[model samples]
Target: MSAPPVHDPPAAGVVRLPHTGLQVPDARLRVVRCRPHYVNRWEYRALLVRGEQRIGHIRGPLPDVAEPGPAGVAGGGPVVSFHPRGRAFTEAELEDFAAACRLDGQGLSSARVLTLLVDEYRIEQMVRGCARRGGVMARCCGEGWVHYIPLRAYPRSAGQCAAALAHLERASGVGGPWRIWDGQQWSPLSVGSGPDTSPGCA
Candidate 1:
């Protein structure tokens, strides 16, 4: 049987997202809740909202979507909860992953922990995906630029991967999309800054 519609006095016109064609009706969410998905333990299921009027909660990270963890939750890893958008790994989560992999992450620098995390992902592909190495869930990619991705979630496409570069833990640039940082901290790297660091420096 269909679940009884949880609405009183009903709702008005549903809001249709033009790009994705997903229609969401008017639902006031005073509080939102989240938990891991049951069937696809890989995904998370948010309780949608609290106190009555509500829209259905979201599933996993959508393409170009924002991080889905509850608001106010500090984002750092080795204990990251993976979303489509990359999430910072928490130290605890990092340790757990290390233990499962029979490796160690104790007292390591954040960058070093991230490197170790990437190494295990390389050494064990499917095992890492299926098992719980850390609380922060992640998927694997081959190598290169992805080596130091701060957010461990796998980028599904070029756009997704490019979007993540800005948030990378060891990224070597500045600003993003439009703003450029000419390779020097506090310096400028903009559209016509060109092959000369001399102008940005001085």
Candidate 2:
């Protein structure tokens, strides 16, 4: 019924298996397996420990409070877009938007970021640039201790990111009846969206 501890509880943020016994239905947005060969290899069950450290059984499921969270307007935080339209965002405003995702102190509870463009051409360009030049808006997502953007969301160069895999809690909009890719499919982010009235304030 319950899985025994393999090693001392992972250090904060290190991915670990869901508790065997007191499993909460929705406590964790996701549970993943980490490969010992990979860098983020903490996604598996605790490994077997040796010596006098046998007391390292997992205490119990993390309390509900341990859920990762996002700040500023639910999980939306602030969204950055490549759409060169109605409003232009200063560097500061863009960074602030990224900051909202980490307020909850959880690992990136939501890593699905919405990127919009003026048209298919620009969107394609962004995609191409990410491929040729390496990295994409996902990199711009932020590096705040893996909070602004979950390590999982980070696209390895070009169009390799599976943002949809992670839970998208909150989001903001900009550019065109811009499309929204909320871990599901591409749809309109807003029904009756309009351009921004102020500068750099998406």
Candidate 3:
């Protein structure tokens, strides 16, 4: 005897279940690109963004140190510390960078500026000052709209991963068509910081 034919479900506007083999929508896929400053080390000085929105930049010169000796003492090998020196672009610088990117006249409101450095102590001091006065520390990472916010508080030493979260928080509170650097030029992110009630140019 012949077997019965099987019928498949309708395919029009039907929601499909998610599985390992399933394909997701292109909009849902996250793509990450890196612009490293150096090789063999974590010296990355590049802009980070999500979709069309700018997130921040990552610049670092990670240290390369050896392990301790048998007695838990310092070793004889040379102490290698990766200290890449590069200034984070300021709001004005960012405005120029953005202009170069052809994104002139764009504005950023209530945004924070973050800088990831090896010096934790310095960052801590700065953060403390900003916290007290309710101001933000603006650093130039590169020439781009993307900026970063540290997930944690500033460290207690220099060259530590100091979070620029407080700065961002303050920027948002003060109201800005704040300026930012886009590597090659500077541009505004929100509205222009005017003399009436905006943070003046830096």
Each model's Cα RMSD? 21.1, 21.3, 22.4
- For model 1, the superposed segments whose C-alpha errors exceed 4 Å read 1-31, 38-41, 50-57, 61-172, 177-202
lDDT of 2 by residue, 1-202 (tens): 1112222322344322111111111222221111122223221121111232221111111122222443212233322122111233333433332223221122121112111101122333444444464332221112232111122223333233323222222232211222332222232223343322211101
Candidate 3 residue lDDT tens string, 1-202:
0111122332243211111111111211111333335566555443444356444454433324324442112354322222212443344443332222110112211111112111222334544565566443343233323232322332323233222323554744533333333222223333322222221221
Q: TM-score for model 2? A: 0.15
Model 1 weakest lDDT span, ten residues long: 180-189
Which pairs in model 2 have colliding backbones? 6-47, 68-106, 75-170, 76-170, 76-171, 164-183
Name the regions of candidate 3 deviating beyond 4 angstroms. 1-77, 80-118, 143-202
- lDDT of the candidates, in the order given: 0.30, 0.24, 0.30
Q: Encode model 1's per-residue lDDT on 32-125: one tens digit a residue.
A: 4544445533544443332463433334432133343332122432222222222333335433422222111112232222223323223233
* TM-score against native, each model: 0.20, 0.15, 0.17
Off by over 4 Å in 2: 1-118, 139-202
Pick out the ten consecutive residues of candidate 2 with the lowest summed lDDT: 16-25
